[model samples]
Target: MKSINGKVIWITGASSGIGEALAYELDKKNCKLILSSRKEELLQQVKNNCSHPKNVRILPLDVTNFEAMPQKGREAISFFGHVDVLINNAGISQRSLIMETDFEVYQKLMDVDYLGTVAVTKAILPHFVERKSGHIATVSSLMGMFSSPYRSGYCGAKHALHGFFDSLRMEHEKDGIAVTMVLPGFIATDVAKNALKGDGSAQNKDDDATKNGMPVSELAQKLIKAIEKKKMESYIGRKEILAIYIKRFFPKLLHKIILKSQVR
Candidate 1:
């Protein structure tokens, strides 16, 4: 089994869902964790639950605050002396059609889900490059690889991450920086309820499919293993992962079916 003992990992969006669960799982392996999110209270709560409570520290931050990330990352590095891994998992979901989405809404999604991740990654890249070792793990939706209705902004943001990070992996391979792109199907997170609608309001409710999706704990476990093993890419979830295969081998048929499917 892959292990993360003695490694220092920085995880964003650690206040809830997959991020919070990952803190618990990784803590058990005695990995020093720097947990970040907008909610300081929630981050503290998560830190308290870690198996190695003393090894976990909270660094509340808003991912979109690009100007502040460099200083924040320096603070994070000071917490553990060095960071071996960075998980860019903080993101918001969009729940509106392309035509219905406002320009600001789309921009916000990109700001948080794409540019936000990019900003943080860049802030920490020098550290990894100097040391010649680091890992980057991010959460991307399956829709990122295959577009679906009612999630145009979200898909755009997620798809952008694939393009940016995939290129970064190639360029940084010589620096010993590993990038793992995690594609999750339907995860049992509050993302649906928290998703933004066309008018910039919360969807304020969960979808049936999301309610019955994979548990947060399970996804966290799988992600930790992926990072430890330095896997290039991996997908999590139930039946949704199969869509990647269908789109690859049966593109025309998949498109026809998706056009009529009930995604929203």
Candidate 2:
């Protein structure tokens, strides 16, 4: 649409990082918000910081709970009649070499990043289809576009999202639905620290590059502009964002750079 003003938006993973920044940014635009995350307290904190506090509501949820998604969808719709936009920003990251990674660790990444997103999308699709109008924007990663070391599972999950959402866009184009896949490079978030390790434990610390990446608010602002314009996709970051372009025209050069880069 033209702007987020007065439109009802549902954002998952609103407790922090990009999701929280989005809530604040859109709130300033007068958008009504339904924020969800596993941490209700943190979600509330985010809601409190919104420009229009009255326009924000907190709904805690775990995206992996597929069975409960229908009820969650109903609750979300009841809160705002019908959601005009759904931001699927909830996901976890993985940081482990495949050979050293545990199978369960890899599975958890798929469960949280891929299947969880699918579950939320499936839950909301019926409403969008019935109404024949809605926007689905998701936060995938730069790794989704290009592979990286020690992130096999994370890359695989993000790659799966690209495949699934690309197909969804084609299938639902006639239904007046739109899908925007956002590919974010390293932002100043604690995702690296909280990412899953090979033993199913938290990495509990940020990587060097991620720690010094672009500011979250800046990325959030740009992403909001892209959403307002209904752009099909937008890539964000400073240096890392270039990887997506380089991977396209100079695949060999990109591989050589990645091989020598200290991602971990």
lDDT of each: 0.90, 0.90
Give the per-residue lDDT digits (tens) of candidate 2, residues 1-264: 787778999999999988999898888888999999999999988987877888888888999898999999999999878999999999888888888899998888898899999999888899999999999999999999889889999999999999999999999999989899999988999899889888999999888888899999999898887888888999989978889889999999999998998678
For model 2, the stretches where C-alpha displacement exceeds 4 angstroms are: none
What's the distance in Å from true for residue 78, model 2?
A: 0.4
lDDT by residue (1-264, candidate 1, tens digit) is 256887899999999998998888888888899999999999989987776789988898999999999999899899979999999999999788888889999999999999999998998999999999999999988988989888999999999999999999999999999999999988899999999999999999999889989999999998888888888889998977888999999998788878877777
Residue pairs whose backbone atoms clash in candidate 1: none
Per-residue error for 135 in candidate 2, Å, reads: 0.4
Measured over all alpha carbons after superposition, the RMSD of each candidate to the real structure, in angstroms, is 1.2, 1.0
